[model samples]
Target: MTELKQERAIRTRTRIIRAAAEEFDAHGFAGANVASIVERAGMTLGAMYFHFKSKEALAREVMNSQTEVIEPLLHSEGLQRLVDITLVWSYALRDDPLLRAGVRLAVEQGSFGLKDDSSFRRWERAMTECLEAAKKRGELLDEVEPALVAQFLVGACTGTQLDSQLSSGRSDLTERVVRMWRYLLPGIARRGAIAAIDLDPGRGRGA
Candidate 1:
């Protein structure tokens, strides 16, 4: 494709994804309508199909794109860095439609004929790496296993945000994640390291 055509195609695909994200966020994958997504994009069914083969494909795209919202914030490391990732991701879950829709679809996709776990695994791996770094730096307790801690942190963060979404539309998600870190820190980090860690809910935003 020529440059102009490629650019147009990119724009069209982005439009479709944004529209589909809105529909999925509101109705979830099982209830979302492909026609409604096309209409919301202000494009014809053919145009939507030209970009995405089906609703499943569109949903998968949204799920994959959720990481885009956090890839930039993942630049840091260590235990505190993991906290930053969770808090920033919580902020995205609250504010970014694409991410919120992607996470919802990722959780609900098994019913929609796609049972992908790549999104969750990516998050787990990132957390694991961060914890491993903290362990090497002597920041964690001697008995702490970085891998187990990573899984626990990922599960805790995911569960907290998911509950927050269902409870109050995620308005209190930051506080919940902060509380989670506070509750978890004593077991994972060395007593001396605890004093240096920042658990502020707004820490992610400042980064």
Candidate 2:
């Protein structure tokens, strides 16, 4: 395809994805309708079909794109960076329809017969990388295992956000995440390092 046509196709695909995210987030997989997504995207059925063959394909794309909102933290290292990333993610969970939809879809995918663990594995890998850096820097306890800690962090954040969403539509997720780190750090960090790490829940966003 020519440059112009390729750009247009990309734009149309993005529009369909965003519209599908909105529909999925609001109504979930079973309730979401392709016609509504096409209408919301202001695109014809052919355009959506050209990019995504089915709703399951669109959902897979959404799940695979779950890391987009946390793109800002992809290169960050250390325990502090981990806290910052989770806080940023909690905020993104509240403010980004695409992320919220992706997470919700991932959690509910079993019901839809669309199983994919790549997103969850990615989260674990990212956390493990950060924890490894923190361990190398002497920020964590000598006995702390990066892989275990990474798993714990992912599970904690997932459950915390799920509860926050259920209770307050995620309005207070940042605070909840802050509490999570506050509760978790004492057990994982070195005595001197515990007090130094920033768990502000507002670090990455300039708050």
Model 2 TM-score relative to the real fold: 0.88
Q: Compose the digit string of candidate 1's lDDT tens values, residues 100-160.
A: 8988888777787787877777778878888888999899989988778777776777678
Estimated TM-score per prediction? Answer: 0.84, 0.88
Which residues of candidate 1, in runs, are more than 4 Å off?
Answer: 1-11, 42-44
Tens digit of lDDT per residue, candidate 2, span 1-207?
999999998888888889999999999999999999999999889978989999999888887777666866544568877777787888878768888998899888989997788878778887888899999999998889999988888777878888888899888888888888778888999978778876766564634
Best candidate, TM-score? 2
State the C-alpha lDDT per candidate: 0.83, 0.84
Task: Evaluate model 1: give its TM-score.
Answer: 0.84
| C-alpha RMSD of candidate 1 | 2.5
How far off is residue 85 in model 1, in Å?
Answer: 0.9
Enumerate residue pairs that collide in model 1.
Answer: none
Q: Which stretches of candidate 2 lie over 4 Å from their true place?
A: 1-6, 73-76, 204-207
CA shift of 1, model 2, Å: 4.2
